[model samples]
Target: MAKNLIQVIIAGGRVVGQAFTRALKQEYEASQRAAQRAGGGNQGRKSAANDTFTGMSLQEAKEILNVSDITDAEAIQKSYDHLFGVNEKSKGGSFYLQSKVVRAKERLDIELQSHSKQKRTDQPPDT
Candidate 1:
């Protein structure tokens, strides 16, 4: 009788274990499918970045500033000021337009800073 009870307990344990294992496998496969549909596992994170500024890039920022050279701080600032002024909310300007210009300017600043940092890191130290 005791041997029969032990066997039943072991079988019950195996059944419970298999149920959990199958559930975990299903969850993992669902996540994999979701990731594939999103392009990759990191696609969600990339989209979050894109959503921040309407998917604006460094080149787009430069274009919005209308600067032929992004390195020209004066020109970039002048263009930003001009665009910002024309889009002022109190001056009957479109607030949405003003916000876009602001985002572009901010994006360019971040890009410029990142590039400068990269250059500094790439250069050899002075003797």
Candidate 2:
């Protein structure tokens, strides 16, 4: 019957869709592992910290947060807070955007700390 044929086609389509999804997931995970392996070593911590959880770069994070001056912590926090609230899932906003805001804040914080540390180290000893 046509009904039986339709059912068989639907089932086949679902199987193909599931297989494609699984393959995509496996490929993504493998790529992430390879990136981690490549980033390992002396500069790993700094490099990893500079990147967002979703692999966004420092410049990208800064742009997302609308930050121009890395030393302006207050401005960065204000922008981050506004964007985070705007993207809150409970306010009919997207969880993905909310997470990106969070990751951007984290990356900026790391950069701020690294900057301050470098400044301290670069300064001559106090008399």
Candidate 3:
């Protein structure tokens, strides 16, 4: 084997990690879209159906729920509960607004679950 046969050893780990992150993000977005499509099955209420199950970003969910910290589950639930109750259709609220509240809570739940999973994975295994 020649001593200097290879002038440079390329480290592609970072690139691979970035690509994997992008792919994961795309898959998550696709799943959200599919859920939206499946949930929008109401044919009569065109506007309500269209408004409900829309693709909601993480930031949008945080804003909708007025959540300042994503890790604070209690605060998130409190905000969600208040907004949900306030948007109840029987309480003279718009159905569209209620749907948005539901979606926002769901998006936040997804984020919390992912954060928990990441934490679990980051821990070292017991001997």
Candidate 4:
């Protein structure tokens, strides 16, 4: 019986194997969607650095940065420097880490600038 099954699979060649693979992939995708809907998927999870300026959730980023309690500019800068330094090592000569650091800095700077502007605007103008 096993021999017969093996022979049949071999006879079906690439087409049958591909069909099976496609079906498995579809099932996997469906399960992933269901998981996401249940809030048990990684799709909504944000890395620490991603929370900076890409419109990702700040809470998630703070958690990733491990500095959710610290909000000072100097502290944030120190954290950024530390994270960038760790990511600077190129395991595969890829510059992905550096790029991410640059993006995070840009986002932080923009946020800080906007915040300062808001603060200034809220003040009473000199008579």
The superposed Cα distance between candidate 3 and the true structure at residue 9, in angstroms, equals 54
Top TM-score hit:
2
Against the true structure, candidate 3 reaches a TM-score of 0.57
Better of 1 and 3 by lDDT: 1
- lDDT (C-alpha, whole model) for all candidates: 0.75, 0.82, 0.73, 0.59
lDDT, candidate 4, 25-53, per-residue tens:
99888756544543453533222223423
Sort by lDDT, best first: what order?
A: 2, 1, 3, 4
- The alpha-carbon lDDT assigned to residue 7 of candidate 2 equals 100
Off by over 4 Å in 1: 1-54
Cand. 2 TM to true fold: 0.60
Residue 127 CA error for candidate 4 (Å)? 3.2
Better of 3 and 4 by lDDT: 3
Off by over 4 Å in 4: 1-66, 69-71, 90-94
Question: Over 4 Å off in model 3, which ranges?
Answer: 1-54
In order of TM-score, best first, we have: 2, 3, 1, 4
Instruction: Write model 3 residue lDDT over 1-127, tens digit each, in one string.
Output: 3544443222366677889999999987765665455444442233232334446766678899999898999999999889888988899887898788888888777667767887999999999
* Tens digit per residue, CA lDDT, model 1, 1-127: 9999999999999999999999999988876664555356675434334434455755577778887676677888999999999989889999988887988888777656655777899999999
lDDT of 2: 0.82
1-127 in candidate 2: lDDT tens per residue?
Answer: 9999999999999999999999999987765665475375644446554563547777778899999998999999999989999998889999999898988888888778878998999999999
